[model samples]
Target chain A: MTGIPQEQNDLAYDVFAKACPSRGTLEHVTGRWGGLTLGALHQGSLRFNELRRRVDGVSEKMLSQTLHALERDGLVHREAQPTNPPRVDYELTPLGRRVTERLLALIQCVEGSMDDVLASRAAYDAGQRS
Target chain B: MTGIPQEQNDLAYDVFAKACPSRGTLEHVTGRWGGLTLGALHQGSLRFNELRRRVDGVSEKMLSQTLHALERDGLVHREAQPTNPPRVDYELTPLGRRVTERLLALIQCVEGSMDDVLASRAAYDAGQRS
Candidate 1:
């Protein structure tokens, strides 16, 4: 029997499918610090240190890892200037910008509804106590 | 320091700030199996077993945990049917639906661009080796 790669034939990747590559992309964009980093770059290119400051609490190692992953996924552009002490900058690729805009909107939605969420949780916990 | 809690004064919850509550919601919505589970429930209510099946590779423990977190966040409604063999069904709340819809769109975008991503990765790797 001739072998056929099922994934290519499956019009849309099934993130629900454990082996699907789409899950990796989903995780990359939504991964902790992933969305935030994208948002930071949306304004303009940011140097490594500036990005580090923008995304608080991210260790240098984690920030580097996140940037590497996004770059590999074609969502980020990394530029290292030629100098005695190299200066590196990070910016969003066109595809990344498209996705980042949506991610930011999603974040805005959550922020807008946070009051409702806090109220709901408070009520739920109080009811549980009763 | 004037006793104004900084978070309260910050007009919007900042996920990048690390201390903001929005990060919790973002993590919950985009956490492992979170997006998939919500997408599964979006179609209709699903039982515990059915959800586990729908989100491939999710263990019973993880499925239960994800559902509970979503319920706590007011994104999922869990109904435990009283019977000899108890039945539990999970569905998205209005709040949950709103977030799930965005998550699904993000997933779709990633899938649609997988070919581009694959090509980019291949090129990056080839350049690295050269």
Candidate 2:
């Protein structure tokens, strides 16, 4: 897959490559707000307020930015409601669902090792101070 | 797990919370160079230059910073040899191996959907132009 069909494959970006768009996409997928937003949306479609609460600690500006990024990435779909005040709902697209599953799996694994990680940090910090 | 054992759990940070240390650790696990470094180290131990080559396009400053962060987190261990040239090898710690496995899983999933993501971006940009 390295050098095959240079013209065609050249268009396909590799995250490992510094110049690739995939690197940016990867960053968005794993960023702090991005990760939390996906985690919330993974549960179900969420309105603006619901999403804001679900992610916890995310400000309106940050949530808006994260959803915009996700929507632009085609992982999320935003639908506006026909109401006097206007309402918007956010949901994960098929592509978003796939990415969320993988990310959540990683999050779970990290949580799984929380005990070990915390312990290691304690030990490391103690050693560093000595 | 939210409010149980306030004192004990307080010490155990939650990533969802804004002030949690886990959030920073999670970011490191998923950052550009951090992700690539973990992917490379997941395979096995490697010397400094070998690691630099493996995670292509990483500057010496960035790699050093990333490795320092990972080491401080106890996710990576650095072994320096007693040679005149001072050879150094980096490997994933047990906790690191677990985190790396999960992070790599996410990275692979992202790579798996590269086609969809790229196509989505193209369609998005095309639509924005219209």
Candidate 3:
């Protein structure tokens, strides 16, 4: 098609016409630590330490920052209980659950096709060297 | 379900088991300027200056950096035609096209659901204050 179909064009414009909400969501959801945190929370509610454990390479500072962003955005619900050690738990809010489901699907799609992408990279690198 | 279905778990593990190629692709696709560049190129091949115009808010330095990453990863084919004005056209390789199609889909999905996300954010902020 020479241009996006009118309906699709309208949809795209509707997205771009606003003050750019996607930029913020994209920042929160796709941040370096954000994806891994969401992936870990997808399984169940987690304490701060539990999240740290589940997402392998994230440092304490990054994980805390990511959790705060997600929390502020309303995707994650954090509850603190008065206890000896100050127990806290994090779980997806309804909105969080919906977004996480979509995120997981995207992650799966990427992971599934990664082999082809790697092969493409190898070929591209080889061509560049020769 | 208590856990991801065994098959899905295998798939997830398969993805996490590797040296994490998704990390690189994720970096390229979701880089600050990368998504916009891909979206602009999706319409058709264009010269360097043309791309700058189509994707609003990108700077020359960021655009050049993004193009190089995509080029290295084989998602973009940069054809430099030896001519007086130095005509260079950037287009998607077969791999690029495949990936771009998926990226566009993701962008559309995010755009479609942005309103809900905004509403959620407002509610979240209100809750925090009270």
Candidate 4:
């Protein structure tokens, strides 16, 4: 709490507590598909299929669920243009952008440190085998 | 990758790719219990019971499993002291510390924004009902 931004000090929610709403929102934001979805959208607004492609292995059902959760949480905006087929696009809201900024920072850190992690994993496995 | 640190641009592992090992490590770091466990340990080293207490609602089995995954990833160091009861303490490794720093930033962002998130959820649910 002390190290966090000063504005957060007086907030009513504590994610460490079980019943706090913040915990649920936090889970949605950091969940496997949610995080990737947000990261993919960070580049800009993308269509549904574009998102599925960018997120790699996410199934259609999983992607749709992830988007719905994010939109319900007010982190994503869904826009539908009534064209012949009804073109729909998903984009991060202002709040979503703010949250995704922090998420991307975390992603970058993890991606950068993978070499160290792989080496550590190898050593750990070798120890286990011995 | 464009906005990430310059050193990371050339890395072979990309979290966006489905098969990359970084994706698995990222999940372990950001998963519900894994994130909380690391956050609790970030405060300082703690015994198994102390960690369970600090993390709020984590079950014994989940905590044990989380700790094992983190240890395998080299993000956590588990020390078992030979004593009458054989005390075990969990703490973050240097790599874990780095990952947790970014995760805490994301957590703080979400915690501080809970009021907005709650208001958004209410509005969403009301719209659904109407």
Backbone collision tally, model 4: 0
Residue range A1-130, candidate 4, lDDT tens digits: 2464557553667888998888889889999999999999999999999999999999999999999999999999999998988899999999999999999999998888877777788999999999
User: Across residues A1-130, which tens digit of lDDT does each residue of candidate 3 receive?
Assistant: 2244646643643322224767667657766678678878999999999888777777899888898888877778899989988999999877677667766665665665565666677887888899
Q: Which pairs of residues collide in candidate 3? A: none
Q: Candidate 3: list runs displaced more than 4 Å.
A: A1-19, B1-19, B127-130
A123 Cα displacement, candidate 2 (Å): 2.2
The per-model lDDT (C-alpha) reads: 0.82, 0.81, 0.72, 0.90
Pick by DockQ: 3 or 4, better one:
4
Best by DockQ: 4
lDDT of 3 at B17: 29
Which residue window of length 10 is worst by lDDT in model 3 chain B? B9-18
lDDT of 1 by residue, B27-81 (tens): 8888877878998999999988888889999998988888877888888998889
- Clashing residue pairs, backbone N/CA/C < 3 A, model 4: none
Score residue B35 of candidate 4 by CA lDDT: 92
Ranking by DockQ: 4, 2, 1, 3
RMSD of 4: 3.8
> Which segments of candidate 1 are over 4 A away from where they belong?
A1-10, B1-10
**What is the C-alpha lDDT profile of model 2 across A69-89, one tens digit per residue?**
888888899999999799999
- State which candidate, 3 or 4, has the greater TM-score: 4
Chain A superposition TM-score per model: 0.89, 0.90, 0.84, 0.91
Model 3 fnat?
A: 0.23
lDDT of 2 at A45: 96
Residue-by-residue lDDT tens digits, candidate 4, B17-77: 9999989998999899999999999998999999999999999999999999999998999
Candidate 2 or 1, higher TM-score:
1
